[model samples]
Target chain A: MKVQSVAVLWQIWSRKSFVTSSTLRAFSTSLINPSNSILMSPSLVSLDCPDTWTSGSVQSDRSSVQKYTSKHVAQILDGKVMAEEIRSGIALEVKRMKESIGQVPGLAVILVGQQRDSLTYVRNKKIGSEEVGIKFLMTMLPDNCTENEVCKALQSYSENPSVHGIILQLPLPRHLDEGKILGLLTLDKDVDGFHPVNIGNLAMLGREPLFIPCTPKGCIELLLRSGIDIKGKKAVVIGRSNIVGLPMSLLLQRHHATVTIIHAYTKNPDKVAHEADILITAAGVPNLVCRNWLKPGAIVVDVGTTPVEDPECEHGYRLIGDVCFEEASKVASAVTPVPGGVGPMTVAMLLHNTLESAKRAFKFS
Target chain B: MKVQSVAVLWQIWSRKSFVTSSTLRAFSTSLINPSNSILMSPSLVSLDCPDTWTSGSVQSDRSSVQKYTSKHVAQILDGKVMAEEIRSGIALEVKRMKESIGQVPGLAVILVGQQRDSLTYVRNKKIGSEEVGIKFLMTMLPDNCTENEVCKALQSYSENPSVHGIILQLPLPRHLDEGKILGLLTLDKDVDGFHPVNIGNLAMLGREPLFIPCTPKGCIELLLRSGIDIKGKKAVVIGRSNIVGLPMSLLLQRHHATVTIIHAYTKNPDKVAHEADILITAAGVPNLVCRNWLKPGAIVVDVGTTPVEDPECEHGYRLIGDVCFEEASKVASAVTPVPGGVGPMTVAMLLHNTLESAKRAFKFS
Candidate 1:
């Protein structure tokens, strides 16, 4: 019976091999020291468990035993569904505003170069605007556009009475200074929330930013709509990019979570990630999170959408998130999928911010 | 002998009452759950002791065992000493600039009201500037001064070719909009780093601010001078105010530390503080940090300088830091004392920022 119990224990314990190694080392050390009889109490805990360990059913039990085992499959957050709901709500608001004020919200997107990714993003934004009844305007400049040329275009957008929001698609050109060109856009018209004043306000307490960065804002919306409570939860954000990780952490902190950001320079990231009740990864590294890296039943939002070669797919590439989906889905309580998750939410948030700007500009309730 | 060991364990454990309660709950639960043998190992860790527990000699032996017990007295992170060293360095650089460029740095201070603390701070900054050979200029306005008056004073200073930096003493008359008035100052002349653009830069990655907030910058300087490694460490800042807590948290995050801020709404601040390798308190609550509120051997910086009733002193009230100093000294690895720690450093950082502004304005190396 003892031998059979040990084998059962090994099977259950092997799943938590990464975290339990230190505990096992302490247990082994206690065996060598007679004075460590009190320490033996922990090892005896395994002896009391029945051999009825099953990896398939977690709903039947909500005890620590179930928590320790990686048998639970996460419920999908479904950002796509939430975003569609928000877009519909925004469309209703737009309709009401246009009826009252006889003017629709307008957004201007400035694209400098022929970068395929930037062009695609701009097109998606335009489509989102059209769906929401927002007037979409675009300013396309050559690859060799000067800083002055970019600044001139932004100033025109800022001065235009019809344009309620202006966004400069990032990575303008190698020769032009991005900061200087962005600074030319008036604060009220900076819909992307990249303006320093907006970012500074976001960092300050008792202050409100004109707009939160769309991607991070979307992550927060996903958590909120899915009923994931952020207050006092241990949240680990992987990546420190300004657009995603930095602002995501700030938003989480504002929501009163104990937030930690793990960047490329971070040591022992897996250990940190495993300790979090909520884990958000924007590291752009494909499949960085496996089952072991997550706390059992943690809430996860994977922001990374990297294109990896896959002959099995028709496009010759498939989108993979920072999290290993198949394995992580078994451990996390709720997880946001890569393609259908944060991408649509970002576009939705952008439209939301533009609508807000128009309302404020037009003096509507 | 077993009873004696238990008693001794109780005494040591009681010192960490807040933290050990969770541990004890986990231990007692293991006793109830016969299946949790692995959880039992942690409870037994208290049994293997050699009866040589003493709280006094922690300064002598800096080991892991010492870290587990709240016996070690913290080394003083003396900000006075560091500030003196920095001021001397700044003075030497000022002398070199005078000899090379035949021009010395100048600073302008704008005081809107006659608040006692603000007056004292402005006076100390003047003294520090004079001691460092920088030209000092001041413009004092009455409590009833109009917003235009403040803006006019700021504009004059901004246009002055000799003035390198401008600072507005905080707590401007309650009626005036502080943010709007401050925004009127040109970015280059804004040395206080409270300008939205400067703060925005501080919040963003890959961007550097023209000046960092003085108090937060001083905290970083103290930590750096004390040889405290920030990278990969768990840091907790107890406050969310714009000037101190918010910027301090941002600065720590920039240094690559896993950071958490415990604001008014945080549910388990004590547990959060106990887990931090580095803790900074700027909440302005006197004696908010108790001995049990720290991880043994943790580094602490108290930014709160609240005036509390002290009838024994010549003055009826005395300045007390947010931390309960006597108790915290016994638990922390290093701690900054109230009056001498962050105060002098704030003044020193002001002078340093002014020098940097002058260097940048003059295009000097």
Candidate 2:
């Protein structure tokens, strides 16, 4: 994965640190434990993996785990590479479906306002969709559009036979009820999966989600690409936003990773940061993390992206992530830098989801 | 607050011998150690109350905890009465709103199929809603209704000015997609708060849930009613179902309790249970929990209700919860029973939500 992709995934997961750490921890420890009834050991969170040898058990590398070995560290979770892989996979499926079923996957982006960031995001998403071979369409509604007008327009698209997936850019106009406006998308066509039902299903373990949030999806892409063992590892997510943090934690916990979420309000946030095998920092604060807050050999994902003034930069500013990269690089076994980390991954996942929507719509998967 | 309630609460918290032994060991040895972040400083978990001094510390007597003199323990939480209190609170608001605003809270129940249990649950929920002074309406769709038809009906209720909350009763016919139906409900009218947006919001600690699921809501009721201080305590949620287990764990974690979710497919489920100050069992298994599964003074909320044949009972069947109530009671400081414990509280919370929906619709608040 590209370094940029990891940061985006990190930000998403960091948003869920407080709750994810402890829950994901239970998953890892419980995997090898056999003391409780199997009800808690349902097939999904089955801890049938290798028994965590006693704390004193010998390792392939007898050196302290603080030192890296093939066993301790695998390939970096490059979201960029993984995103390419997913897009390529989707493109192949799109090609196959076009030939075999005479249909293509379709994703419709709904932009309600003219925010520059939203515009950049949508443009990237559209391009990503095109790259992945999913059919893409978009609509721009005026900022002053009433909730009913927006609802009516969305209803038409939702009922349209050809539209398989729909996404309305975030930070919709102030007058519209964000929740109600998002509700207008069809569940099957809800490419963003911000729909409450998908979220509810995601929250419930053992159930599957129609669509997962983009950032968490990106993080999962990192984990799968890196071949890291999430089951039973202590994962901490920082931040608690609906878009990134909460759902990211749920996804990790579903994979049986014990997860903890740390938030701005947490009394001892720093103490919580040190407990992670996987540390995700999504709070937007620049240089919020120091070396002491990290455990030895931890894999860190930095999700923060703040503009800090730099005299050397031509733009008069440089993009910085939530983590203090200089300090973290030494303490963390490996870390994803801010600008090149999770950002790229989010775009890739969006394309991936759009492709998925297309495939499901076309009955290709 | 009351003798019976305190016993039930204690029985809910503490379960069995192995749990007690391991917990006792962990508690006694950890307070003085800096590495033990899992257990926080003594001052955080408990208030400056008498029972807290005893229960919050190690080696506190099970019998003594029964007294629950702590402000956060026996005196603070009582799920049964607390649920009732919440219901009455809602009822009072509902009555006031009806008198002042000429509008009653309206809840629409969509019951699909003829599963006996599902039907019973829907009916019970309807009764509970009416009892709280929320207007209840039912739409019983055929068991074999098409997913599209269900989606349309759910949408209608979501848009209908009369309906403030819409509930699609669970265990829909196997042919209909649950995700699609859940997705169609308007997020604002999603009183159950099963929608992804709401759930995604709930999973992040600081974000407030627009609607909290009935099961987890009920679990909170159990604790608040039983006087258990959730802050900075070790909580374990057994089962990771999005409905009861995962959300249950997250909500507890939000209260500042360190929560772990043990689920099926988890490597070692029982070992995780031993670490909990509070244990919530939501896996739908009968007698899944034995005395050995619980800590002596741990609180247990058994959310599962499974039916088993019992020739001794006149009905020829008996309902049991996830915990072995009788055996667990002796060992646990408090326990919620299979039939009467978390079950009623779910309905009560639903009613409260319905009333809330009405209040919001009428601007009563």
Candidate 3:
């Protein structure tokens, strides 16, 4: 149960006015040039050059400078639409399996504690699974439950023949050893892809992981579906969490992108970020990346989803991304929006992984 | 089974004259300044700035310019000396175990082919093990040996009470599935650390690998013993091989170094290499890196060892490194020599890993 810090909220609030103003400007620009609206932005004329861009800048040139002023408003990647399409395809596959073999994929989740965000995430997964015609199951435990209780729940899932994919929701209670719990899950049933062997396969050359952690897999899906080139591109991934950033970097490298990983201990992250032809930020720090941190026309994928309190919103809060959306949209060639971006795709990928696992189990594919 | 390319030999021969001239100059500088000889060199004054170093160079400054001309001759990171020290320490520990419990560690190696280089390497491991009071065993098979034979060999060592560490010599015959064969070795006895689970643990944070691959572990030891600071430093690794480059980058990241991996598809590798405070090259391309590829005062670890024909030498060939030794010596603060550098340290680390595995098995401290 990690809480958003006050400093992060303060930073998001401080930029709220700027976001509003820039959104209006972007909208006006789009209205003025409807046909090429996705690539045209008038507000980019005033964008500042990154601090690292100097006369002797290795990656900077007159052409890059000229291209910077001709700002390309980022086309929305629209992961929501992509995920919907994918889910529909998955639904059809499940239906086919049901009609042919009278069987459907089964996914089980073991969730401990009652963290609001985790609860919401689990609910979404359940809905997503059920919508795809897959059976969904969960085991919820109190926050103070013993390690043995959680292990028991995992053991049941592992032994169940119907359970094709099992996910142990992360950030387990403080007392339980997360690694030990994860190791106990049968490798073939580890749909979450947190097992060491799965990760090792992902990192190694000429080997494939049983499952790629959902978020990074989804991000790659969005990129591929958008027809963006990854081979030989310079990719920079911010944050090195095992789930997102680390695996994302490895996946990108597998796709032949020259990748650099920036973490908390990195010096001058902006300078490194600017070198990226494709930038993926999973720092979870809202507004951490600004316009100056980008290379103009670079593809930006924001995996950060921090919830900030907003009394005016329907849910009394809003999701913010690592990038300032308005600022990034003015410079990047394409960008994924917060709520409509990686989130939906992550859920979609989970369903896809489960279906694949079930298919393997049944030897149907 | 891997042979050096003719193009690589030609490149080495072309650079031979320059290496000779610079070595003499370096020798003269050392003679003049015997007290501070390790850091003083006269040849650095003529070194050229890296192509990426421009007026707006993010990492370049007046101090860097002055430092460039100061020409700090690289102090040798002597793996030979370090390996000797470490082996002596292992010998004492093995003696203590023998006296206290009447037990000693045993290492088993399975060599599927009689490749000259692989045979030499296996022989060295045997000598190193025996020197440290560990029992040494080898199972040699012809190049045409069947996959079943290799698997049977691995199974025997795996079940043997005396054998604590088992190494499957790499580059198996073309007919054999390398991964499938390596997988046959039991995890506890996987001293070479090629097991995917071991690599996954090394890559993931908050997890520990049972055994780290020998070469990368030895490179880190060299840097640590040389007093080179890794935390927060920009480290660049050239090549992405499973055994060296991939694990090296992950290990450096674990040490808090901001890591960037450069491979064949990487554009402008020298520009990225120049940004590193610690540069490790395992590209296997002889003299692939020059002075311009390094930052002044960078610590370089050369893992490349390509054999080039030399009738004058007793072995009829000499090993060449990826970095031009003379050029790197003039610019870098420290550099490891190809043959006596990572090679010996790798063997020492193998002995260390075997001892640790044996201790764990015997329940010895």
The sequence of per-residue lDDT tens digits that candidate 2 reaches over residues A160-266 is: 76778888777788888887677667888887767766776676644567777767777766665565677667788876556676677777787767776765444
Model 3: lDDT of residue A243? 84
Query: What lDDT is reached at residue A330 by model 2?
Result: 66
Answer with 1 or 3, whichever has the higher TM-score: 3
For model 2 the TM-score comes to: 0.63
Task: Report the C-alpha lDDT of model 2 over B88-170, residue by residue, as the tens digit.
Answer: 55555666677887888888988887875566566556656666677788888897788887888887788888898898877
Steric clash pairs (candidate 3): A56-B55, A56-B56
TM-score of candidate 1 on Cα atoms, chains taken together = 0.77
Q: Which DockQ-derived CAPRI band holds candidate 1? A: incorrect
Tell me each candidate's RMSD, in Å, in order.
19.6, 13.5, 11.5
Task: Point out the worst 10-residue segment of candidate 3 chain B by lDDT.
Answer: B40-49
Docking quality category of candidate 2 according to DockQ thresholds: incorrect
Best by DockQ: 3
* Predicted model with the maximum lDDT: 3
Candidate topping TM-score? 3
DockQ of each: 0.17, 0.14, 0.26
lDDT of 1 by residue, B1-365 (tens): 00001111112112232323434544454457664321111111122222121122111212342443445578999876566656656676677789999988999999987875566567667777877799999999999999999999999999998999998877788888887887798898777787777787887766777788877888888898788887668789887767777888877777767777776655456767887889998877678788778888889998877765679854355676778889888888899987778777777777888998898888975
Q: What is candidate 3's DockQ?
A: 0.26
lDDT of each: 0.72, 0.63, 0.76
